[model samples]
Target: MSDAAILCRFEAARSIVRDAADLAMAMRPPPGGPSGKQKSAQDWLTEADGAVEALISERIGALFPEDGFQGEEEGRTRTGRLRWVVDPIDGTSNYARGRSRWCVSLGLMDGDQPVAGIIQAPALHETYTAVRGHGAFLNGRPIKASPVTDTRSAMVEMGWSNKVPDGIYAAKMAAILELGAMPRSGGSGALALADVACGRLDGYLEMVINLWDVAAALVLLEETGARFSPFLRDGGLDRGITLLATAPGIATDLAVALAVPLD
Candidate 1:
């Protein structure tokens, strides 16, 4: 598609995602948190997820009838050359608990390539946007990955999912620690990856993460000069797989330590 076409979708996505964030914030639970249910161990599902996704799906569908949509709540709808993949409420656990870490994520894809994306974290008052070859941004300012090259000084977030075995999780955690880098887990994969993009964190790795969780962040990482795994090349288009995104300085070493491939 032409730059104009992608930019059109990118602009529309920013507005749609912002409105979705507003809707989510209004429905956010109080300090005590909401009575959310679990889809699985540590995997939360809340009313806002569906509501926000419905709004995004409807708006995107209306604005671009020919584009496809794949959302966390409703799954895939119409098919088109450019697909909109959304995680209406990424970090639902945090959102459920009224924490300031959740976000509404939307990504534009051309086949397997993430062409553009918008990730809005209303609670944190931060928004990240990126289009392929156009660079990434935090709020309205341009952003880039950290220049830290030392493992000992780098901080990496290791995302946890119930889908992976306990042993596997432990092994990866140990690997990160062995690298002498500080390791952490922040519950939200998208935000963690976003953190890597804007230099808040050096790297993010997850044994199993879905397309919606990382789709939007892919372009952010790319435009910010962060190195990441070849997720789609490794079958991420059809199913969940390990994901490792890191700064260029630390990417090679981090990938080896975690046994994850770099793109």
Candidate 2:
């Protein structure tokens, strides 16, 4: 597709993401309270999750019937060349628990790499978007990753995968701490990457995260001048992959600390 077509898709995605975020915010439960069941030992699934995903899929499909879609709740619908990756609520556990750190993530891919994306955290009143080389934005203003060079002063968010072994999570955390940087986990990979995009967090690390979870944020991070390890493009979609998105200064050090294999 031409650049103009991709930009149009990018604009369309921004509106779709906004609508999805609004739906999620409306369905969000009261603070400090939750009404949802466990999808797994720790993973959560709420009525809002499916409701939001369905709305996004329906709306986007209506606008671009020829485009494919993949959502966290409904899985994949392959119809054509372009694929819309949607995470109705990136932080389900936090959303179910009434925390304000989750977001609605939407991304478009042409073949392998992302062509456009958006991550909107309505609860936090923050919206991030990017079109391949068009730069990234937060709340309509341009954003950039942190320029900090020292690991000692870096603040990185370390995400844990429920599917991974307990030992791996522990080891990764320990590795980050040993590097003399503070490590934290906000329970949402999309939001974490958004934070990295806007320089709120210096870096983000995750052992195994889904494509829907980070697809939008991935583009945002890239456009914001943040560095990241190989994700689904290298055939890690169904199998998942270790992820590292960070300021340029910490990329190599972080990979080394986590023993993340470089591609």
Candidate 3:
């Protein structure tokens, strides 16, 4: 597709994520009285997730009825060739607890590849945008991953999920420590990946993550010249995928430390 076409979709996604972020912030309930249910012992789902997703689906449908849809809250709607993937709130636990680590994530994918993405963290007052060939931006300012090349100097963020076994996370974390890099978990994958785009974090790695969580950030990583391993190598696009994103300079060592396949 033409660059203009990608930008057009990017603009639409940008608007939707911003609107969803605004609505989510306004509707957030007090921590003690939060309206949410446990999708699992460790997974959470809030009213904001469904509400924001419903609004995003409706709004995107209005503008692009021919496009497909897939959301963390709503599942799949294969209406057309291009699909708009969304995660209304990436860090539901943080959002449910009134923390500022949540974000609204949206991506436009043609087939299995992301072409455009937008991530809005309202509480943080930040918006990140990216297109396939165009560069990435943070609050409209161009951005890129950090230039840190050595594992000893790279400060990386690690993402965790209950879906994966405890031993897996332990192994990866130990490897990171052994490599002599600091590892931190920020509770939001999309936001963490956005930080990588803007050079705030040197790297991010997760064993298993859904498409919604990383869909938008993948585009940002690509446009900013950050490197990441292919997600869900063993499953279809609808299933969970392992994710690893790093500044180009630190990618090799980090990947090696984590035992991620470089091919």
Candidate 4:
């Protein structure tokens, strides 16, 4: 499809998620309290997540039925050459707890490369989008990565799902602290990546993230001139160990400091 057509679909998809998020915010649990998916001790899901996923899937199916879909709440479906990766509600834990840091992430992938993306943080009134080769935008204005060069001057964002071992999370935090940059956590991979794209944060690191979580934001980061690499040399979709996305000139230095081996 043409870029304009993709943008139209993206906006429509974003609106669906935004409305879902709004409804989720006013939601109350039943007598038993909130329902959740115990994927494991650390990973989780909620009714809102599934609801948003259904909404996105329905919209995408209606608009682009030939495209495949891979979503956080729903699994994958095979179709044509195009695939849509979606995180209907990223940071579900935070959402379940009423934190305002969650978002909806969507990306259109042509084979393995992202061709279009959109991330909408409804509570924050922030929307990030990009079409491959068309540059990135936040609230309709173009964005670029921060020009921060020295680690000491940079403000970094990072995250680790609770699934990560406590020891490993602590060690990574310590390593980041040792780099002399201030660290912040937004609780959402997609949002943190959007921040990097808009120069709100200089860099971000995560121990592990699914393709659906990062696919859309990765395209925005690339279009905005941000850089990223896997935490290990072989850390691709297959390995899924770690990921580090950074802004402009800071990527190499941050990767070196973190000892993250690029693919």
lDDT tens digits by residue: candidate 3, 148-183: 888898788889898788998899999888888888
Q: Kindly list the per-residue Cα lDDT of model 1 for residues 191-256, writing each as its tens digit.
A: 999999999999999999999999999999999999999998999888999999999999989999
What is the Cα-based TM-score of model 3? Answer: 0.95
Q: What does the lDDT come to for candidate 3?
A: 0.85
Please give the lDDT score at residue 139 for candidate 4: 86
Misplaced by over 4 Å in model 4 are: 1-38, 230-239
Whole-model Cα lDDT of every candidate shown, in order: 0.92, 0.84, 0.85, 0.77
Question: TM-score for each prediction?
Answer: 0.98, 0.96, 0.95, 0.88
Error of 2 at 83 (Å): 0.6
Task: Report the C-alpha lDDT of model 4 over 57-176, residue by residue, as the tens digit.
Answer: 887888778888887766786566788888888877677666677788888887777788888887777788888888999988999999998888889987877658888878777777
Where's the lowest-lDDT run of ten residues in candidate 2? 232-241
Candidate 2 residues 1-263, lDDT tens each?
A: 77898898888777877887888888898877666988787688999989988988888888889898998878897556788888888888899988998988898888767888888889889888888889999888999999978889999888877788998888888888998999888989988998998888988888888899887888888888888877865655665677888888777887788877444
Give the lDDT of residue 141 in candidate 2.
94
Question: Model 2: clashing residue pairs?
Answer: none
Q: What TM-score does model 1 achieve against the real structure? A: 0.98
Off by over 4 Å in 2: none
| Comparing 2 and 4 on lDDT, the stronger one | 2
